[model samples]
Target: MRLSVVDTELCVGCQCCMFACARRSGLGGIASSAITVRSMGGMEKGFKVIVCRACDDPPCARACPTGALTPKPGGGVRLNASKCIGCGRCAQACVLGAVQWDDDVNKPSICIQCGYCVSFCPHGVLAMEDK
Candidate 1:
């Protein structure tokens, strides 16, 4: 399963989803989040939610020289932190620009599509669905 953008038009740009993602990692800020919300251009243009689509064949996994990245059953990839050398290869392989970086740890914060952020979204802008 993966997250789907239900409706971008309804987004109010509150960034609750971003905070929720950070909270999932037990972090106080968005630094470790796998999701991001940003303005398309300005506040009036609404926000763009940047998240992993859980690709069927994740490029990030293939780019892992240490085999740190492994694809999930439905979509996306899971990082084996033990194997990750903070190489940042997986982040570079992400074509959709969904792989968020953890500069302190030198790893990409890829989404597992657990829908934690979706629950926090005030507007119905995001949803968890079968691929």
Candidate 2:
């Protein structure tokens, strides 16, 4: 599947994606959501959409000593928290800054491509396309 961003100009800087990403654990919590979008300088200029681009070669997966990060069937990274050692190396390895830190849990929050956040997005900015 291809991760597509359409009509990004319509984004409201609401950070609904961030909160949705945090809701992937199916518990309506931000403890495990992995995406984040924030303002570049100010909200007036628009928001910066930050999410895993389903990289062909993901550095975060490579940096995980415990192999917690793995390749998803569609083309994104899947995080196995049980295997993770709470190391921040994967977060540092992600160039897109898609990997978020769970301050409360002291672990990396990686996207699972569940599209839960996409459903919560009020604006039609994020979409999952079968490429």
The 0-to-1 C-alpha lDDT of every candidate, in the order given, reads 0.87, 0.78
Note the clash tally of each candidate: 0, 2
Candidate 2, residues 1-131, lDDT tens digits: the string is 65567766888988777777765655665666677777878888887787777877788888989988887765778888789889899989988888889887888877666676778789888998775
Instruction: Give candidate 1's TM-score.
Output: 0.93
Writing each residue's lDDT as its tens digit, candidate 1 over 56-109 gives 898989999998889988778988889989888788888777889977677788
lDDT of 1: 0.87
Checking candidate 2 for backbone clashes, the offending pairs are 21-33, 22-33
The C-alpha stretches of model 2 lying farther than 4 A from their native spots are 26-29
